[model samples]
Target: MLRSIATFLCLRCQPVTALPLNLRSRATHSVAENQQTVEALYDLSVDIQKVRKLKGWVLLQSPAYTKEVAELLKNMGASGPIIAHILTSHPEAVLCNPEQIYTQKELWISVCPNQRELVGIIEKFPASFFTSSSHHDNQRNNISYFQSLNLNKRVITKLMASAPQSFSRPVEHNELMVHTLQQAYQELGGEEANMKIWLQKLLSQNPFVLLKPPEVLKENFLFLRDKGFSTPQLLHLLSRLKGFVTELNPDSMRRTLLYSQDTIGCSETELRDIILRCPALLYYPESTLAERFEGLLSAGISMCQITETPTVLELTTQIVNYRIQRLKARGYDIRTGSLEVLNGTKKDFEMSFGKLQLRRERPLFNPVAPLKADD
Candidate 1:
C-alpha cells in the first residue's frame, strides 16, 4: 500500500485553493497515474525543485497556471528577486487573471510616464503589483485621498516620492492618522495654522508620519520638549529634521549632546540656545561637529559670532581652510563671521572687496538730427 502523503508534507503544504472533490477523486488511480501526476508537478514549476528530494510530496495543482504567471511577469519585464519575491509571498498570484496584471501595469504607467521612472518605482515598491486588481486599485486610490484633503498634486507627488510605501496604505486609515495628529495639536493649545504647518512638515520631513501611532508622535514631541525646545523651535525641528528626532535613538542624541557640551565647554542652556537657533547641528555627526567650532575658536572667533550665523558650522573644510589661511597669511583676523568667505560666489566675493562689474551701453543716435537741423 502507498504510504500516507501526510508523512512527508509540511503544514504549509496544505491546499490553499483546492480543486473540487470530484476532480481529485477522478485524478486518483493506480501507482502509474499517481507517479505521472507527481512527475508532472515537479516537471511544471521551476521553483518547485525541492519535490525531487521529497519522498512523496507533490503539488496539488497543475503548474500550468504558475508557468503562465511567470511568462506574464517576464513579458512585462519583471526581473530577478522581484519575481521570486512576488511568487513566494503570494502564490495566488499565479492564479490571477493576466488582465489584472495588465490593468495594474497600465494604471502605474499612466501616473509615471517615463519607463525608467516606473522601473524605479517598481524597484522601490516591488510588492505593489503582487495582489488582486481590487486591492491594487485601493492602494492606487491613496493619492486621490490626499487630493481630497485639498492637498495639491505636487504635495501628493512629493509624498509618494518620499515614501512609496505610503501609497500602499488605505486612504481612510491614513486620514484617521492625520486626524489624530491634528487633534493632538489642538489638544496641546495649537492653532489651526499650526496644524497646517505641521502637515507640511509631515509631508516633507517624514512622509511616514501618518503611519506612526499617535502615541509615538506624542512621545517624540514630549522628548523634544524635555530637551528645552520652545513651541516654535519644536515646530522648526519637526519641520527641518524629523528623522533625526524620531528615527534616531534617544541614547545617541543624548551622547551627542553630552559630547558637544564637553568638547565646547558650554553650559546646557548655551547648547540649547545654539540648537534652537540651528537645529541642523543636533543632527550632524558628533565626530566632526567640533572641528568647525574648534577651528573657529583657534582663529579667535567667539561664541557670539557663531550664535549670530550658525550656518558657518555647515561650511565645507575647503572654504573654512581658505578663509582661515587667507586671514592668517595676510595678517588679519576674522572681525565678525566668515559669511562672505564661506558662502559668497566669486563675483560676490570680489564685490565684497569693493570691486564692481563695469557696464557699457550704445550711445544714442542724437547727432544725425542735430546735423540736419544745422544744414
Candidate 2:
C-alpha cells in the first residue's frame, strides 16, 4: 500500500500533459471494473494533484466529476487541515454533484501560496470519504470569509506608517523641500549632473509658480513699456532677456521701475540713465517708404509704378487703382457697374481736354508770340 501510494504521489508530480494514456486507461479500467464510486475516487485524486500543481482550476459540470476528484484526494491521504486550507483558497473548486466547478475556457487563477496549501490538503484526505455534493457554494464563500477579523488602531497605525512619504508631509512643505533640493543640486556645479531631475522634481512639486507664455509675454511687455521703452525696443529687450528670467516675479522690482517711468513722469536725466543702463532697451529703425513699397510688392500687388515726378491726375488714378486692387485681393465684392462709372469719368475728362484744346486752337483776337521775320 505504501509503494502504491508512493507511485501515485510520484505520478501526481508528472506533468499532466505527459501522463501516459495507458496509465490513465488502467486507472479508468480499475474504477470501471470496481464501481462508479471507485472510479470517481481515482479521478478525484488525479485532479487534486493537478490543482495542487497550480496547473489550473477544474470546472465540475456534474456531481460525478466532483465526487470522483474528492475521492481521489482522499485516497492520496490528504489531511483535513490541508483540505480546509485548499477549500478556503479555492472555494470554487468544490462543486455539487450536478454542477461543474470550472469551464474549459475559464482561467484557473490561484496565487502561489494558495496553491501550496491546496496541494498539502490533497495529500491528507481519505479516498472513500470523498463525495460529490451541492455544498460547493458554501465552500466558495468560506475562502474570503475569515471570522473574528478586526480593524484596530494598531493596524491603522501600521498602515499609515507604510504609506507613501509624500502623504506624510504638508503639500506646501513638500514643495519647499523639492525646491530646496533642486537649488542645492543646481549649485553643486556640474553642467550635465542630474539638473533635469532636480528641476523637474522642483517644478512638479510646486506647479503654481509656472507662468503661461502669454502671461509671461504680457508681463514682459508691461515691464519694458513701463521703463520708457518703445514697442520695437521692448520686443528687442524681450527677445534678448527671455533666457535669463527663470522664475516669474509677481512683484518684480524691474516691473516697478518700468511702471514708474511710464506712469510717473521721470526726469529726463533719470530716463536717459535708465535707458543707458538697460542694454536690452536698444531700438531698431522704423520702416522706410521704400520698405513699405517692397512690402506692397511682396503682398502680391503687381502693375505698380513709381516716378520722381507727380501729377494730380496720375496720382489720383494710381490711388484709385491701388485701392481697387487691394479690395479685390481681400475678397471684396466689386461690381463691374462701378468700373463702368470710372470709365465714363475718364472719357468725360478726355472730352473736356479736347474741348480745352479746341478753345486754345481757335484764333484769339490778338494772339501774342514771337513776331514773324516779315513783320
Candidate 3:
C-alpha cells in the first residue's frame, strides 16, 4: 500500500488518457475480475497511500473505479492535470458508480449552460458532483423547485456547487425555510415585485441559510423586535448582513449587545442607534469588540468619538493600530480628527490614506509666485 504512494509524484506530468489502449480497455472489466484499481490510481498519478489512509475502508469494502472516474471527467472537458488533481484531492470520488455520475451530470446540465462551465465547477468542487447517489431524488426535486421560483440559473448553479448539502435534503426542508423568509420579508414591508429578487440575492449570498431550522430565523426576528428595532430596521440589518442573519442565535446576539452597551457606556437608545449604523456590533463576539475598544482607547480616542463613529469598531486591533500609526506619521492626529476616516475596507483605507498624504506633502505657498523686494 505504501509503495503506491511514490507513483503519484509524477502524476502531474501524465494523464490517464496517456495510458496505452490495451490498459485503457480494462476499465470496462468488473471490479472483481479487475484487481487493478490500485494500479489504475497509480497510472493516473493519484496518491494511493494517502487515499488508503484517509478512506481505507472504502477500498476494503468495495473496489474503487478510478479509470471510470477519469474517463467521465475527461469527457466533461477537464484537462489532464485537472483530472489528476481532482482525483488526488477527492479519492472517494472513484467510489461513485459511472451511471450515478452520469445522472448527476444530466441533472447539473439542466441548470448549467454548457459542459465547459460544469467542468470548471467540478474542478473546484469535486465533492459536490460526486456526492451520494441516494440524494438524486431530492436533488432533482430541489432543482425543479428553484427553477419554478424563477430564480436565475446562475444562482441555482452556484448553490449546487457551493452548498450541495442544501440540495441533498428533502425538498420540504427548503420549502419551510423559503416560506419563513418570505413571510418575514412581507412583514418588513417588502413589495411583491421585489420578493423574488430579494430571495435570489439572499440565497446567492448564503445558500447555507437553507440548512438552518426555520424556527431559528423566527426566534431571531422576535429577539430583534423585542430590542426595539422596528420592522424596517430589521430589514436593513438583514440586507446589510447579506442574509447571514440565520447564522445568529438570540443568546449570542444578546451577549454581543450587552458587551457593546457596557463598554461604550451608552444607554439602550444610544446603543440601538449605534447598532443601526454598524450592524456588525450586534454579531461580533465580546472578545473581538473588547479588543477593538481597548485599541482605540489606548490610542487617545474618546468614547464620544467611538460612539459617533461606531463603524471604526469593524476594524481589527492590528488594523486600527496600523492605520493610526500611518495617519500620525502623516501629521494627522486621529485623536483630534474624526474617526470616520478609519471606517471602510482595505481599498477604502488606501484611498483615504492617499488623499491624506497628498494634503500633507502639498506646497502651502505658490512656488512660482513673484518674490517680494527685500524691503
Candidate 4:
C-alpha cells in the first residue's frame, strides 16, 4: 500500500501543464508533502500499511507531518522503535501539526518534571499525548486547578495519561464534580485534614469517575440512602468500592438487591448485611448474580451457606466450578461444610486448600503414639 501510494503521488507530481485543468484542481495536498510524509514514516520503520488501515485518509486527506512528530519525540528522548510503535498504534497522531503538538508538550511539561518522564508517558499512552489544539486552554486550566488543590504532579500526570477526557473538558466541569465529592466527604463527617488524602486515593483508584456527571453521584447516594444506608454507612460503602459508586445506577442497584434477596432467601436487613460484607452484590447486575447463584445451587451449595459468605459470588461460575472440583477431589465436602474456604483470592484459596489437605491426611487415631509415651 505504501509503495502504491508513493507511485500514485509520483504520477501526480507531474507538471500541472501536462494534465487537464480539471485534474490539476483535484490535488488537495502538494504531492511533495504527501511523498515526504510517506518517506519519513518508512525511514522511521513504521508499519505504513497498518497506519493506512487504521486511518486510511491520514496521508492523502490530512497534512500528516509525521517527520515533525518523530523529531519532537526524538527531542523528548524517544528511540526509533518506540516512535514507530506510537505511530503504528495511533496513526491519527500524525494529523496533529507541530504547533499543536508543541503546545501539548508545554502543557504536559507543566505537570511532568522532565522530558524523560514525558517520553515514557507518550510511549505508553500515545493517544493521550496528541490531543486536539481546541482543548489546550481547558487542559491548562484543569492542570492549574488540580495543582491549586495541592494534588502532586505525578497524580495529575496520571490523570492526563489515564483519563485525558477529564482534563480536556472545561475547568468548571471538574470543579462541580470535585465540589460534590468534597460536600459528600464533609457531610459524612470526614476530617478536613484527611479529605485531600481521601480525594487523592479515590481519584487514583478510578480517575474516570471525574468524567461522570455530578448528578449521577448524587442519585446513587439517594438510592443507597433510601435502601436504609446511613451517611456513615454510605461513606464506608464508597471507600470499599474504591469510589466506583458512581458507576452504579439506581435501577441496576435495585435489581441486584432484589435478585440477591430472592436467591439467598434473606430479608432486607440480612441483604444489607451481605452487601456490607461484599459490595459486589450491590454492584453486579441481575444476570451475573443469577449465573453465580445457579452455579452455587448446582454445586449443592445451599443458599444459607452463600449468605454466610457472600464474597464467594465475586468469582465467576467457571472459577467456582473449578475450585469446587479441586476441593472435592481432596474429599472436602463444600455442601455439608461452610463456604469460607472458597471465599478469597488465589493465594488465599491455595493456603486454605493446603490446610484442608493437611486435615484430610491427618491420622484420626495414632495408637503407636501412646506406646512411645509409655516407654
Candidate 5:
C-alpha cells in the first residue's frame, strides 16, 4: 500500500513554478540549520508526498531528511514497528546528523547490554539519543550529581525516562537544583545514609521532582517540618503525597493537619502515624472524609471504631457495610471482629461469605458492588 502511495506521489510531483503561500514556510529550512546537503532538496512538493505516504508523524522537512532517517535506521539494523514509532513521536530526531544519531545509539547500546533493549528505549524516547550526543559532558556531571544524592544508575535512568526535560538544563542550573535539594536533606538531619534515602524517596515518589523548581521543593519540605512531621515521617509523607509533583500550599496542608488534629482528635504522635500510614488522607476533600465517616456511623460503626481503624475511612462505606452485614448474615459475629472485617480486602470478604446471596435484595444492589446497608 505504501509503495503504491509513494508511486502515486512521485507521479504527482511535477516541478512547480510556485509553491502555495501556506506551504512555502515548510519549503525554506528544516530544524537542522547547519546541514546543507538537504538545502537544495527542500522541494515542499516532494516532502508533502513522503509525509502523505508515511501516514503517521508528518516530517516537516523535505524528502532528504525522511530518506536519511530510514537509511540510518536500516544501517542500525532497526526494523518493525520501532522505526514507525520513533519517527511518529520525534520526527525532529531526523534533524540530528547521521553521526550524531549513530553516536547516541552506541551510547545507549553500551549501557543497555543488548541491541533489542537499546532499540526499545529509543523507540519510546528517540530524543534520548539526541540528548546524549551534544550533552555528554553535562550528562556526566548530571549522573555524578544524582550519584552524590545516592541515586543508582537504574534509578537515575528511571527518573530521566519519566522527565527527560530535566536534562535540558545546563550543568550550572542542575548543580544549583541539586544543592537546593541537598540543603533540604541536610536540614532534616542528613546522616550519610539518610541523605541517600531521602533523595531517592523524593525522586521515586515524584519523578517530576527533577523538573520542579528547587524553591518549591524547599518550601514544601519546610512546611511539613513546621507541621511537626519528624524527619522520617516527613520523608514518607512528602513523597507519597501530591507535593512531589506540585507545590503543596500551606493553607491546604494546614487544613489537613487541623482536620486530623481537631476532628479526628489525633494526638501529635497519632497525627504523624496517620500521615505516614495513610499519607493520601491529605489529598481527600472534607466532603469525602465526612461521607465515609457518615457511612460507617450509619451502618452502626461507633466513632471509637472509626478512630481506631482510621484506614477504614479510606474504604467506601458500601463495601464496609456490605461486607460486615454479609458476614453477620452468614452466622459470623461482625461486632466482635469489625476491625479485621474493615481492614481486610473485599475479595477475601466475598470469598468467605460467598456471593452476597440475597435474592430479594438483588435488584437494589449493584451486580458487582457491595449491598446497601438496608438491603
Candidate 6:
C-alpha cells in the first residue's frame, strides 16, 4: 500500500515537471521573436537616415510629436528632399510644441532657426501646395505674426510718446461767457458765418481756440438742439463718449459749432469771424479723423441728434420725406409703399441709391448669339 501511494505522488510531480518545460519553451520563443522585430525596425530606421542624407533632406525631430509636421509631410508625399531641407533650414523647429505652429485655419511652416531659409523652402515647393489664395494668405499671416513677435513694444511706446498732440483744446475767454451779449451782435440771425467771427473776438485772449472759423459754433448748437441735446447734455456727450465718432467725426465738429451758434443765437458769418479771431480753430485737418468717423458710423452709431419736440419731429419727418421724394423724382421707387423702402434701413436706402446710380452709369454687355447652320 505504501508503494502504491509513492507511485501516485511521483505521477503528480511528473506533470509539474512537464509544465515548467512548456513555459520555458514559450518564453524563449517570444524573446527571439521580439529580438527579430527590433532588429528589423533598426534596419528600417538606418535606411531612412541614409535616404535623408543622400537627398539632402533635413531630419525634423520634435521634442514631442507634432501632428502639423506629420500632416505637412504626408501632404507633400513625405518627400525626403523636402523633409531634409525643412529640417536643415529650421534646426530649432522641434523646440516648440506642435500647438505653437498649428492654427485651426492655417498650417504655418516653422520659423525657429532661419526665417530666410524657411521662406526659400516655401518658394521652391510645388506651386500646388500653396497656389491657392487662401494658402498665400496663411503665409502672409504667419509672417506678420513672426514680425510682431520680434517687434519691441517699449520702442513703439517711446516713439508714440515723443509725438506731439494733434489737436489743441478750446480757449477760455470772459467776454465769451455772456451768451446773450454774443447773440445780440450777430447778423443773418444765427447764421454759421457771422457767429464764427464773434467767437474769435470773444476768445481773442485765449491761446488755443477749440472753435475754428467758417465753422459756426451756433450752427453746431442748432444741430444739437434739433437732436434734443441740452447745454449740459451736449457737454456730457462730448466728454464722456469714448469712440471714433467723438474723436474724428467732422459731423461731430459741425454739430458742436451748430450747438454754439444756437446757444449764442449768432449768424454763420459771425461764427466765421469768431473762428478768425481765435486762430487755434484753424488747425490743419488730421488725416485719421475721416477714417475714424467712417469706422464709427459703420459700427451703427446714429450720432445725428434728434429732438423729441413736436415741431422738431415734424421737421425731421419732412426732411426724410423730402429726401425720399427727391429720389422718386429721379425715377427711384423710394416711397414707403415700395417693397425696397419698406424693408430697408436708413443705411440701406443710401446704399440702394448708390447702387442704382452705378447701374445706370455702367456700360451694357451684350453677347452675340451663336448662328444656327440652317439660318
| Clashing pairs counted in every model | 0, 26, 0, 0, 0, 48
Q: For model 3, what is the alpha-carbon lDDT of residue 232?
A: 93
Candidate 3: which stretches are off by over 4 Å?
1-35, 59-61, 365-375
Q: Which ten residues in a row have the lowest lDDT in candidate 5?
A: 37-46
Per-residue lDDT tens digits of candidate 5, residues 24-58? 44342334222332332242122433333443223
Instruction: List runs of model 4 lying over 4 Å from the truth.
Output: 1-33, 327-333, 336-375
**What tens digits encode model 3's per-residue C-alpha lDDT throughout 258-279?**
8888888889998889998998
lDDT of 1: 0.58
| lDDT, candidates in the order shown | 0.58, 0.36, 0.84, 0.85, 0.60, 0.36
In angstroms, give how far residue 87 of model 6 lies from its true place.
Answer: 22
Cα RMSD, each candidate: 12.6, 30.6, 7.5, 7.7, 11.8, 29.9
What is the TM-score of each predicted model, taking all chains together? 0.53, 0.16, 0.83, 0.81, 0.59, 0.18
Global local distance difference test of model 2:
0.36
List model 1 lDDT by residue over 1-375, tens digit each: 234545334332443333364543223322322344433333333343333233223333333255566666656676655555555444545555777767766656645545555545554554454445666655678866776666645456556655656676677777777776666556556688666656665666677776666566667677768987678767666556653454554555677788877865678888887777676676677777777777767667786676666767776556676765654544445656354444455455445433211211234565556555554
Best by TM-score: 3
- Please, what's the RMSD in Å of model 1? 12.6
TM-score of 6: 0.18
Kindly report which residue stretches of model 5 are placed more than 4 angstroms away from their true locations once superposed. 1-57, 67-79, 89-92, 106-113, 126-137, 147-150, 230-232, 235-247, 259-270, 284-375
The alpha-carbon lDDT assigned to residue 19 of candidate 3 equals 36
In terms of lDDT, the poorest run of 10 residues in model 4 is: 24-33
Ranking by lDDT: 4, 3, 5, 1, 2, 6
Clashes of 3: 0
* Candidate 2 lDDT for residue 223: 55
| 268-353: candidate 2 lDDT, tens digit per residue | 45654444344322221122223433443343433112111111112233544554464454444333213221222555545644
